[model samples]
Target: MSGFSPEWLALREPADHAAINAQVRLELVRVLAGKASPKVVDLGCGAGSNLRGLSPWLPAGQSWTLVDYDQRLLDAAQARVARSPLSPSPREGGGTSVTYRQADFSAGDFAPLIAGADLVTAAALFDLVSVPVIGKLADAVTANRQIFCTVLTYDGIASFLPEHPLDRAMREAFNRHQQTDKGFGPAAGPNATEALAQAFTSRGYRVIRAKSPWVLDQTFERLRRELDQGWANAVRETGAVPVREIEGWIAHRLAAQDAVTVVGHEDLLAVPV
Candidate 1:
């Protein structure tokens, strides 16, 4: 299993993430209504990023369960939550109670972990989860008549620097690799949003879908580097051409970013159904 490397965090670290994610959270809050505090489960809740964004809007009495298969990430998330002002202490208004579970949504059944939640959500998770697995999750949540929301899955396409020939080739190769099933019984990777939506709709979810793509410009240097690396790795994995040529392309592209245009991604927000 590929661990969540600092490289991943570096890519995710951005001032805009907090604001953009808050917007996504607010959208979910708008649709889910209940007088009593609702239970919430954040599947693949890495380091509690979404929790940080959602806690303010949720009622003080609401209960939360955070789940991630990675123990290191789960521990980190626990620590972050405990340190936040919203900690279960009375001073924080005691509006929300939180719990963290280290479990893989792919292997462990989510039904029990998320049972009875007014809302169950995942950010950038569905793209990595297989269709069969997603189907199971849809069944589990629908069986309980719960709402499910997933955001920001890759659409197997990303806009890239204009005038860069290698950029298009790399993206095409990576997207193809993303479509392969990674020993998970069912395929995941790219095109995940469409598949998940179809699964939920078929399972009787009233699906509400939206797009939230990342159109980061050269201003986002770190994100730009990560995107380049991601594309390079995919090109390497495919073994479609000479390794040296791919490396050369990556180095050249990275160096040429000053003038090269970059645009990539198709983000999707899918609600239950």
Candidate 2:
């Protein structure tokens, strides 16, 4: 899969943190109750935002293995995690320890990475992978009996305030673009949540899913603008809609007053039954 820039990852981290489903996180915490030094593997650990956001809720003395295809991102994640107050302090006994690995799991086996992990997690990742990739991950997690949690699997829901005539078309086209090869075969895209649920449930795992939508308003103007531009680009790639119409749609969206966008996502937790 293509690597995301640190800048884009940084821009989205706050929204990602804010959008986490409280109930799903609580369930994850519940499953991880007794381990003083739990082992976690974070796939595609972009800037380690997931760690920064989730570490405080986990057990003390946690050890994390952060894996990504890009060494630069891995480095950024390590540095960011080390500095974040939300992460466990770097003091002796109760401090959290982190290891970074550069690997393109898309092209090779990732089973080894999660071999002894108590929990395997990823954020904003599954939606870009193929169904077979998800199945492979499910098999690995189930075989190891590791808890699995993934958040921000887009659900094809994009609603913009002051609705425009071309919004639906743009959204549909963009979703189609999402399914294009993202270095993991045909990407699951908006169908990722259902794919994940089915994959785990069929393996006798109990699955919990909750909505984790990004409710962007005026306060998030920069992110909102960037998101709109991204959508427009994806829609253009599909060629399912005219370029002029897509451009006009984005212009209207960006220029509109008090615009709000709700981009739907889901958080999934799969625990051994």
Model 1 Cα RMSD, Å?
A: 3.4
The alpha-carbon root-mean-square deviation between model 2 and the true structure, to one decimal in Å, is 2.0
Residues 151-257 of candidate 2 have per-residue lDDT tens digits of 88899899998899998898889889889889899999999999999999999999999999999898787888899888888888899999899889989988988
10 residues in a row with least lDDT, candidate 2: 84-93
Per-residue C-alpha lDDT of model 1 across residues 1-273, encoded as one tens digit per residue: 534653475356452253244455566667654425778899888777767655666555778898877777777777766776465423235567789887766663778888879888776676667887877887788788787777666667566654456666777777777766654554577767788778777876666565555655666766767767777887798887568878887777677746332332233334554
For every model shown, what is its TM-score relative to the native structure? 0.84, 0.95
Superposed Cα deviation of residue 78, candidate 2 (Å): 2.1
lDDT of 1 at 229: 75
How does candidate 1 fare on TM-score? 0.84
Cα lDDT, all candidates: 0.67, 0.88
Show pairs that collide, candidate 2.
Answer: none
